[model samples]
Target chain A: METTPENTAHGYIRAGDKEKLRHRLRRIEGQVRGIQRMLDEDAYCIDILTQLGSIVAATEKVGLLILKDHMDHCVRHAVERRDEADEKIEEVVSAVERFLRV
Target chain B: METTPENTAHGYIRAGDKEKLRHRLRRIEGQVRGIQRMLDEDAYCIDILTQLGSIVAATEKVGLLILKDHMDHCVRHAVERRDEADEKIEEVVSAVERFLRV
Candidate 1:
């Protein structure tokens, strides 16, 4: 189709979900810009490392939020479809491993 | 609602996309299991290192596939919806940074 459906039969987003996600991201954006300024000024190595760690933690939190949504929406939908449930689960597990590869 | 719905109004997956994704994930699963075997028997450091690299690369490929899908579907959908598009872009970029942290 030339245009995405107004709402796919399978869409997952809710009105509130979008708003909440946006707010969280805005905060993260500020954190990231701060990191850039630190880098530009050649901030102390340990200080930079601390900020880096915070960024990583913040990013991981976002990933976890997305993953939770996936479980609630995508995975739940797939399981109800009566096909590929195990495979779908395995896919999520694979994703978690990739996410935790640090 | 307790139900995830027959399809969300925002569903991104198409029939062909599902099949292709499953096949790719299955292969990645096998590779992961193989890595476990290598670890189980105390394989040579170099040999293990090689497989670990392969796993990271394979996982990154999966992430790339996902990002492509997001850009094609989720990002496009968000843009058309006239919502927090910039925030969403920054969110994705933050995700990329976390993914490349290694």
Candidate 2:
């Protein structure tokens, strides 16, 4: 489906939150570059792996943040709408399950 | 940053692939809802966990697909551009590292 502005407006992510999400993604991008530079300089594998661990942690943080936003906004809105409350609840529950699995 | 059509056009996910990705997400949404119904019916914990594991696997597939698309399109484009090739390469490597961590 086409992602119109109106669609986005009614979706889970708030405008401000989306901006923050993008900022976080950009930072992650930078971190990745830093790791590459380290590799080029023949950095120790353990040190590189440590940085890799940090990146994984940071990425998970971003994912969790988005998941929380989805629950707070998308799932909540679905509950309020009553049109697809069951479906919405299930979606959120499913997301929570997946999140916890990590 | 604002997700303009132009920006998307130049980015990783191709138009056809985006449609497929959305379809997969919708399926995941359905699976999640199904799990909730199972929970309400007092399903076994192991069964529930099994379903949750499926969701995780499916989610990981989606993430991997997107990551591959990023490497093929965005990273490749960046490399061809030669302007920020190092940064782009690193970004992809970081993503791969995170994916493998799971």
Candidate 3:
């Protein structure tokens, strides 16, 4: 595991994952800036709420990506380490619930 | 971008961050298992609520670590790229709100 790349987008980020995350985050970024401009321009409350919801959804996607990576790497490694892996799994399960509930 | 070491704990994880994160997660993992046992033993409602609160706090700590990484890497990089970095900052701001609100 000492051969991981640094910044090739494939190094720390999973293959193809960086592109997807970047694309989504870029969009979210735009939506957020738009919201700020809207607020500056005094847009309606419902409009702002709608934008907030979209931002929330986008943020959730980011959380999911990280969650997937954690499961694939951290949790899986723990499972191979020993029988105590169940505890790790439970932590992840509870985390997912919190993520989704938000 | 291409020099990140793989699995050295320093590859993706910040020098000291992994140790801290792992330690915290280990403790949280134990707490979670204890919660399961408490539930199994039919612990009182307030007891369960307190455990849930602790779990939530632990989760928030994890989230904060990730947020720090994102700001130090992703947001800072975006800022160097151009003025559009403000939007990225806003996205992170909103995400923090969502994180804390939960």
State which candidate has the highest TM-score.
Answer: 2
Q: How would the docking of model 2 be graded?
A: incorrect
Cα lDDT of model 3 by residue, A2-94, tens digit: 212221222333547646755665565566456445434434323344455555555555556656765675567679987559976887777
Question: Once superposed on the true structure, which residue ranges of model 1 sit more than 4 Å away at CA?
Answer: A1-9, B1-102
Comparing 2 and 3 on DockQ, the stronger one: 2
Please report how far candidate 2 places residue B1 from its true position, in Å. 11
List the DockQ of the predictions in order.
0.04, 0.03, 0.02
Ranking by TM-score: 2, 1, 3
Expressed as tens digits, the lDDT of each residue in A23-85 for candidate 1 is 878888998899899999999989988988887787777776666566555554555563554
Task: Give the i-RMS of model 3 in Å.
Answer: 20.6
lDDT of each: 0.66, 0.56, 0.53
Clashes of each: 11, 0, 7
Q: Tell me chain A's TM-score in each of the predictions.
A: 0.78, 0.78, 0.70
Candidates 1 and 3: which is better by DockQ?
1
Candidate 3, DockQ score (0 to 1): 0.02
Candidate with more favorable, higher TM-score: 1 or 2: 2
